[model samples]
Target: MGKNILVLTGSPRQGGNSDMLADAFIKGARAGGHTVAKFATAAKKIGGCRACEACWSKNTACSIQDDFAELEPLLESAATLVLASPLYWFGVSSHLKAAIDKFYAYTRPGCKRPLKIKESLLLICGADEGLGVFTGAIETYKGIVDYMKWQDKGILAVPSVSAKGAIVHTEALKQAEKLGAEI
Candidate 1:
């Protein structure tokens, strides 16, 4: 059996470590007969979500519209979601930050409702190996999981990988593949 999975690559660099990790995960998932819809934030033109409250008052979705309009369906329909991004200043890339902000539709007054994600994973890569490296990003990821009340599959954080494709260290790539296969 196959599942509909949405993979969001929230990296500023096309071939960055986070992107590679996402690709590895997607590849493993495909090999396991899962259907994946992969999108790169760097490839799309999106803006930060403005607090218009239009999705609640105006409609049942976001008001500050852009490519995100095309994303809502896939996001809502996916059985599993992989939010992978390179750690930028202890958090996700600006690209992903914007995408996440638009999810405000799910947080508006009328639009604010419980999200029912079947399964989810947070894949993050950072350059610093400090003990608290992933703390900030982990908080952000946990916030989403808590908001949606989604099944938290797991979280993978790779440290000391700053350059592109450097996540080959810290066992992140292998973990990503394993996560996909298991998911």
Candidate 2:
């Protein structure tokens, strides 16, 4: 049976490099018989986590309502979670960061809430090829996976691609598809 994959993409620019990579992965994952659902974080109205702990007291997932509320159910049902984002200042874009921060709500002590995702994949695109350009984003994802005890599926970091649709000429697109098929 195929797995349910939830993709959260963070790219303010539509058809940007990171979004292209996400599309490639989604195509491949779908071709491989996996069900894929993608949400464009940059286009959503999600906000930063308030840390009010109201979710714990109210028996809710998140207190500050926004697009993240819409994703809660999908997050719960997905078996594989894919985070695709464009590197900004050697870190993840704020669009994606906001949603990731809300994950803390689910980790409240004795919350009894557990993410259904068992595996995670990271896909990042950046313009600079500098050393450690992708370090922060990768580590952030790693921290989440480790804390959640989810398997780190893999990472695809495509550098030197700044312009939108630049990834169309690169082999990374094909490789991304292949990675999806493998999953």
**lDDT by residue (tens digit), candidate 1, 1-183:** 888999988987888888998988988899889999988876788888777657745453676657876777788778888899988888888998888888777755676433445788888888888638788889988988887777888898888888876777567788889888888
Give the number of colliding residue pairs in candidate 2: 0
- TM-score on alpha carbons, each prediction: 0.89, 0.94
Give residue 143's error in model 2 in angstroms. Answer: 1.4
lDDT per model vs. reference: 0.81, 0.87
Candidate 2 residue 83 C-alpha distance from true site, Å = 0.3
| Least well predicted 10-residue stretch by lDDT in candidate 2 | 51-60
For model 1 the local lDDT of residue 122 reads 87
Model 2 global lDDT (CA atoms, 0 to 1): 0.87
Off by over 4 Å in 1: 56-60, 109-116
Model 2 per-residue lDDT tens digits across residues 1-183 = 999999999999988888888888999999999999998889999998987777756455787778888888888789999999999987789999998888887777756566788999999989987547898889988999999899998999988888888888778889888878888
Per-residue error (Å), model 2, residue 151: 0.5
